[model samples]
Target: PRWRNIFKSNATFWWSFLSGIAQLLYVFGYLGAIRLTFMPTAYKTTHYRQPLLDHNGIDILRIESGYVACIFRMPSYDPSLPDVWQTDALISISIALTLFLPAVAIIVICSLLILRKLRIAKSTDISPQMRATQHQLLK
Candidate 1:
């Protein structure tokens, strides 16, 4: 469609309209929201065993002992689930790759096509004004 007719695209025009509903559904489903499953928790490993002592060998900084505020974890998660899915890194990387790969591929392909078109427009004897307008609109 022409640049001016972009806003007047018909209902069947799917390329111009980008919706987030699919991503939302996929993300929620993949994360097991419907099943009330909260997998992949952080694990606290912070520790301080060395205590500061005064001249008399008394405990100077008596802050606390075993106070771990560093980690979160999926404590008491279901054991029936696969171990691979329980890992945060696996889930995150897999979900991102699966959801975004197709979109990224489509964008790259469309960008190449537009670039080719622009090159052709430039190679031809088209007015520089028209070429600039096309480039701007494509962008």
Candidate 2:
């Protein structure tokens, strides 16, 4: 009963905590999208041809390249270039959002709703039988 008063007193605080968790999720999601979208992929070039100087002229080597290291040299990679820092940051953020943030949000929202319903019951003039039934059903 005393603790019920505490929950009643802190309804706004619980709501704010839930809002904060949601806002954290929003911020992390936005940052993760940015990191994933604008990140550079290794450049690719196809059918690369060049002129060769011999006694009279020109030749070409048709090639496919992943990254152009220089005007004369192009390197190919099996996968795109890696950015360890960005990748790690994104992964850490995703874990925090997907795992930690949702759990916190759920706890805060459930607590807030329970407290709000309890406060509503307290404010309303309900019969003792009704209160017992509410507690039994809810708990």
Candidate 3:
């Protein structure tokens, strides 16, 4: 019984460690997926609006037209912005579906196994011969 207790404690410790590692891996895998899928792209000014010549004598093109210029020049490539919010949402859903839930399932299975072992140990009756053998082995 004493040795079983010791082994049980050790098993619990190792199971906790493994679960921690699994959780860390899940988080990293999710982050990696987001990084790979929605990578940042270079901003393009022309995509938003046509450049206009300044009223000054200088020939430099200006991007300061009215509301149309404002509408055209808005940044749309970054994933964190409202323009690309759907991309971020899709990446999050995909990672959760593929990686995070599986890790949680593994942790749950380990917990259930430990509970089953404890229940069996409590319900079993030790015979005298087995108790004597266990005592002798401990000595």
Which candidate number would show the highest lDDT if scored against the true structure? 3
Tens digits of lDDT, candidate 1, 1-139: 4865764443223332333444454566555532222221222112111211211232323435422121123222357864222344445556656766665555566556556666865689588898899999999
Better of 1 and 3 by lDDT: 3
TM-score per candidate, in order? 0.32, 0.31, 0.41
> Which regions of candidate 1 are displaced past 4 Å?
1-4, 7-89, 125-139
- Candidate 3 Cα lDDT to native: 0.57
Per-model root-mean-square deviation over C-alphas: 12.5, 12.9, 13.4
Q: Report the C-alpha lDDT of model 3 over 15-80, residue by residue, as the tens digit.
A: 777777888889898777655443332232332222222222322234243211112123354558
Pairs that collide in candidate 3 are 48-72
- By lDDT, is 2 or 3 better? 3
- Candidates by lDDT, descending order: 3, 2, 1
Q: What local distance difference test score does each model get?
A: 0.44, 0.52, 0.57
Report the error of model 3 at residue 61, Å. Answer: 21
* Model 1 lDDT-worst window of ten: 43-52
Please give the range of 10 consecutive residues that has the lowest summed lDDT in model 3. 65-74
lDDT of each residue in 1-139, candidate 2, tens digit only: 7988876677667666776677667677756654443332232112223212232132233223222121222233334854223344455456545765566667677677867777986869698899899989998
Candidate 1 vs candidate 2: which has greater TM-score? 1
lDDT of 3 at 114: 72
